[model samples]
Structure formats: C-alpha cells, structure tokens
Target: MYDPKIFKTYDIRGIYPDQLDEDVAYKVGRAVVEFLKADTLILGRDMRLSGEKLSGALAQGIVDGGADVIDIGMVSTPLVYFAIADYGHEGGIMVSASHNPPKYNGFKICRERAIPISGETGLLEIKHLVEKGKFEKKPSGQLIRTDVLDDYVNKILSLIDKKRWKDAKRLKIVADFGNGMGAKTLSNIFNTLGVKMLAIYSEPDGSFPNHEPNPLKEENLKTLKKLVLKEKADFGVALDGDADRVGFVDEKGETVTGDIITALLSKEILKDNPGAKIIYDLRSSWATAEEIQKAGGIPIEYKVGHALIKEKMRKEGAVFAGELSMHFYFRDFYGVENSDLAILKIAELVLAEKKPLSELGRPIKRYFHAEEINFEIEDKEGKIKEIEEKYGALQNAKVSHLDGLKVEFSDWWFSLRASNTEPLLRLTLEAKTKELMEEKKKEMISLIQG
Candidate 1:
C-alpha cells in the first residue's frame, strides 16, 4: 500500500526507501504530469544522496508519460521554481525535504508559472493518481540538461539597486549554510554584490555535518551566533537545507525572529512601493502588523504555509509576504519565497542605516513573544477546542479560527493550532509585557497539556 503520510500538506516527504523510495518517486512524477496534462516538465534536487536516484526515477516516469523533461541537477527549491517560471514550463518538481534530516527527501511540485500544488491544490489529485497505479505508456520523451544559475542570479540582481549596494559602506557579514544548498547560491550572490562574507559550513553536505539546517531552533543557530560575535561582523544569515527560507543573527549574535525580519523588510519594501499590501502569517507577532502600518503599507494577515501565502500575495497584489517560519515571499519573484532576495534586502537595510542590525531592529521589537511550543497529544483537535473554550470566556477576548484558535485580549493573545502532519498541538503566545507573556503562556500550557 502507498504510504499516505508521505503526502503531506505542502509536499511529499518521508524516510527514504522505507516510506518513500524510487518506485514512489517515479509514480509521483507520472501522476504530476498526468494530472497537469503537461508537455514539458522541469526537475531539480537538493544535495541529498538519494536526490539523484529519486530525481532520476521521477524523470523516468515523466518520460514514460511522454513528457519532455529539463533536468537541472543539484539545485535549491527556489531555483527549481525559477526554472519553471523562467522557461514558462507547464510544471516542475523539486526533490528535497527542505530542512528535514538527510535521510528524508521529498518532492515539491509546482504547476504552470511555478504555482505551488499543495494539498488543497493539486497534490491530492496526484496522490490519488499515483495510488491507482495505472499509467499508460507512451513513447518516451527526451531529456534535456540545462543550467539556469546565471539566469537566476541576473534576474535577482536586476531587482536590487546596484548603485545603492555599491555606494553603501562595506559591511562584513557571516553566513552558515548548514552544509546545504545555500553555499552554492548565497556565495555567488554575495560575491557579486562584493560583500565581505565569512562563511561557515558552506559546503553542500547532505549529511548535515555541522547542525541541522533548521535555524528556527535556537540551538541550530549557536555556531552562527558565535562566529558572528567572534568576527564582529555587521550581521549574519542562515539558510535552511534547500535555501528557500532564511534566519538572521544581529551584530550582537542575537537570533532575530522571522517576524522581526518581516517587519524590517516590510518597511524597506514599502519605502520603495508605498501603500502596497504586505502579508504576514497569523502566528506572527503583532509588531509585524504594527510596523507595516507604521511604514504606510497595508498589513494583511493570512494563514501560514508558503502555498497559502503565495496565493494570498497574488490575490492581494501584495508587495511582500512573510511567514514566522522564515519564508519570505516577493511579488517580483512570481509570488514565491526567495531568501536570496531577503538576504540582499537585509544587507541593504543595515548598510544604508549605518547601524547594527539589533539597533535597527529595536524599534520593531516591541513585544514579548513566547516562542512556539509544541506538545504531542492524541486529542490534538479536542485540546485546541478546550483551550479556545477556556480562553474564549475571557472578557474582551477576540477569537479567530483562521488556521487555528487564536484568542486575543487587550494586552495578550495566544493561538492553539493542531499540527497538520504530526499528532501535536502548537501554541504561540504574545503580550504587551514579559510578565504578562509568561503568565499567559503558563495559563495556556496548562490547558493544552491537560
């Protein structure tokens, strides 16, 4: 039987060979082509050892389904998206598990113009087709090998202000690639922009020789923080395995949350395009929305997930959108997350301001946020309902059921959402004061745990 769990909300991912292997990968490829009714398909993979085999199997299935394939080997997730949109291909596939461990790999499929095919989109259709296991064999389609690295770089550079970058004071920056795909793309971007870069673990090692590529966890950022401090760099940035999202460290080596990055970038983007709508996920700190409005940009809140955010950006004609998970989306990027742009924008912000990142970020750092806490529970949905019911009774409390149960009071707010994949409930609480944040966190955790 096909492993249903591998078909997640965002992509198809699981342990290699056991839950996901060559056979499944091939079927997914065929199913994607069949579902999209496409003639040409683009494909790429990360540096994982299994990527090559899985991508090859996928290509075989695509060819068997009589679809021409443009195979760009060993690329980041964003690059795959770039290729599809750049070449005007009908669809594309990226074999990557993103920040997941090396043993896990998956496929991120996109439709025409590089639009994401999530569970709510066309992912379920592909899953059903693959499970049926009946594919007509047509004459095999030809495979073409091409590289879009130069094109991708040129496109991004065109969006940046070369004169401003050249005129700004040279700043030293540190980056930890986590031995993922960032080393390949970020190095080239930085080198072209002529920034002093002290790179760590920049090599593309699927083994994740240093730490896991996920910078959301504070522990994963320890080494980057140390390097930034020891080197006394202007600031630092870290990218996940596939380089679609990024994390930041200030000059003082303090990890900057994604919401702060969102606020900062929103201010920058709005300076150029005032009144443009800026989208942030619901879980983001209130400061994100406040800062966006302060910058004269319309702040719009949406549910989390790249697919959802991208759709919202397109629908709202948003200038930029950010997720708490470090994914930053741009309208210029065909409504997809591109951390490369995010890194450049941050560098420009620091260089132009002539202040440390922490100092620049201080104005928007106006809240106390209890970082996301996850609890494994059997009755995840019931627990969320219970938390909502408990908190919903509070006077002047507002509850929003967008992606989860978010109860907002005058001074504090908390959100409880059931995990889409795991049997877990996640909580995020924020307040006007640290004491209040702690008090609300404790009060909510008790309800969730019980």
Candidate 2:
C-alpha cells in the first residue's frame, strides 16, 4: 500500500518504490478507468527511468479493467493531452512528476478538455479505492502502441505559419532542456523553423545532470542566463521536467518572469483578434491587466492553477490565458496547455516587432512585485482568518475572498492564501512603486505572522 500522504493537492506524487510502486500505479489506473467508465484511454510517459515500467503496469491495469489503452511512449505532458484530444480518446493520463525532483513521479489526467481529476475532484476517490484494495478485476481488454510524435510535431507547426518563420532572418537561440522530455521534441520544431539553435543537455535523462528542470528558481536558471550572454544568442528558453512550463532569458542575460511574457503575447494576439478576452491568474502583475486593456482585449483574472485557468477560459470564451507559473493555455489549441507553444509564440512576436524583447517591454507599465512568500505556521486557516479580520476593514481598500484574502487599495494590493499542497500561507503583493510595495508587504507580513 502507498502512503496516503503522497496524494497531493494537485496530482499524485511521491518517491519511487517506497511511497509509489508498480502496484500503486496499477491501482491508480484501475481507479481512473472505473471512475471515468473509460472505454478507450490514451497514455503517455516522460523519460524518468521508472516511467516505462510504471506505464506498462498502469496499462495492464487499464486493460484488466476492460478499457483499451493507446500508449504513446516517452512524450511530454502537453503532448499526451494532444494525443487524447487529437485521437478523440475518452480520457488520457501522463505519467510525469512535472518539475519535481528525479526521485519523484506522478500522473496528470484529463477527460475531453477538462482536467477531470484534482485533489478535490476525483483524486480522493482514486486514493480511497487504492487504499481499500477493492478494485474490481475484469477480463483483459487490449493495448496498442501508436507513435504520434510526428503527428504532434506537425500539429504544433501547423499552428504557426511557415512563411512567417522563413521570412524572418535566422536567429541564434539557446535552449536548455535540463535533460527532460523537451529535448526529445524541441529539435523537430526548431529545425523546421530554420532557427540556429544551440541545445544544452538535450538528452532525456531523468537524473537531470546539469540542473533541476524547474526554471522558476534563479539558481536553476543561472547557467542558462550565462550561456545566453556568452553566445550572444537572441534569447534562451528553459523548460520544466515535463516541458509544460517554460522560462525565458533575454540577450542581456536577464531572466524574464512569465507575467511579462504573458503581456507581450496578449498584445500580439489582440492585434488581430480585437476585443478578444484574455485571462491571467490573480498572482500576475497588475500590468498584465492594464496591458490587455491597452491592447483592446478584455482582461479577466482568475484563481491560480491550470485547471482553474482552463475552466475560466471556457466560461469567458477567452482566446488566450497565462499563469504566473509559466503555464499558458490557448483556446484554439483545444485548450491544452503547452509551454512550447507559448515560447514559439513569443519568438514569433519578437521577430515581427524587429526589436529586442527587453526594448519591446519598456513602454508597458511596470509594477514592483514581491516574489511569492511562504510562511510555515501551525494554523494556516487561523492565520488567514486573522489577516482577514485585521485588513478587512481598512478604508480605501477592497477585500475579496475569491481564492484567498486579497486586499486591494488604490495603488497596491496583496493576496494572502493558504497553499493547498503544504502547511504554509503564500503572500503576493504588487504596487505602483517599490517603496510602497515594500511598506505594505512589511505591514502584511507583521499581521500575518502575529
């Protein structure tokens, strides 16, 4: 039996063999098939050493549950989503840890366009079934191997016009794959685009020799930044373990946050699709909304998380959506979130402007944003309640509880929310000036700690 503790707020993740094993994986597969009543399912796995074995066992379980399994071996998370929708399968699962350490592994599931399973959605039910060991066994169905990589690459390339890429002069770019699945798929796309690419750690090694695949961490991005400047490349791109999240570095060796990229892309999209609806997560910079409005697109802010963003996109009929954590979703792409597509879009926009990305970002409004701060506390709910009671009555400030306690003032706002994954409270603050942001952040921290 697996430890119940490993079933997380987002996906099922844990150390291999000890916390998660083939047995647990099979149980999860059985539960997923039963839960969705899936007659046919698409499955993909990352390059982790354990992935192949786990996927095989999971497929076995699915087949045993009388569900046919279509295995697309060794692919990224987004590619799995694509295979599911493109092939019109009933549901799909990607066996990947997604930016976690090499020792960790997990699954990302989807049914149609909806991420049907989350911590509160169907994960708990799956967990309960796994623990109870009451899975119903049935006759074996079928398993088939289908190589969809070429089709996936073709589909992604079709999203961008080839003439646009060919018209632009070839630009030198560096891509640090962090030894994840990105290395496996990026080559085909970049070669087709005719870009001069310098690939680093382009092998699929789950141990992540050069650095962890998480580009959000400055330490993880240090090498990519230095390399970009050293090679004088136009830009550098970084991807997470499953290649679902992307990070960028400009020619000047400066790391750009996902929010800035979102603004840049939203402006480009609005130029053609005027008044299109764009969605950004609440944690994004205030400039994101202002830029969307400036570009003549309606800006809609929603709670954090891919599932939340996708749902809001459907509800608002939003054409595009971006998250501060680097997950970008496109409605035209069957609403499947793809960081590779976002990176390519950014490249295309920069080429179209004939300007450096840094220069293009200057006219946009700038706001001082504090990195998300996490506070470890015994009572997360109590601390949030205290923060609400203290800040709820402040004059000239509006209080909201959409995702957490968000207090909005004329020039500044702060969001204090309990993290779903850990026993901690996360705080994000932004303002017109650095001084004001710091001042408010200090006050909010004091109140929250007390």
Candidate number with greatest TM-score: 1
lDDT of model 2, residue 316: 88
lDDT of candidate 2 over 1-450, digit per residue (tens): 487887887788888878889999998889888888999999999988789988998999899889999999999888888888888888888999988888888788777653547777788888887887776768777999998989988888888756567644568888988899887677888887777789988899988888989988889888888889999888899998899999988888888888888899899778778999999988888899999999999999889877778777888899999988888888878875887788788888878877877777766648899988999988888888888777788788798888888888889998888887667889999999999999988987887777
- lDDT minimum window of 10 residues, candidate 2: 161-170
| Span of ten consecutive residues with least summed lDDT in model 1 | 161-170
The C-alpha stretches of model 2 lying farther than 4 A from their native spots are none
> lDDT of candidate 1?
0.89
Q: What is the lDDT of candidate 2?
A: 0.85
Cα-based lDDT at residue 279, candidate 2: 94
Against the reference, the lDDT scores of all candidates come to: 0.89, 0.85
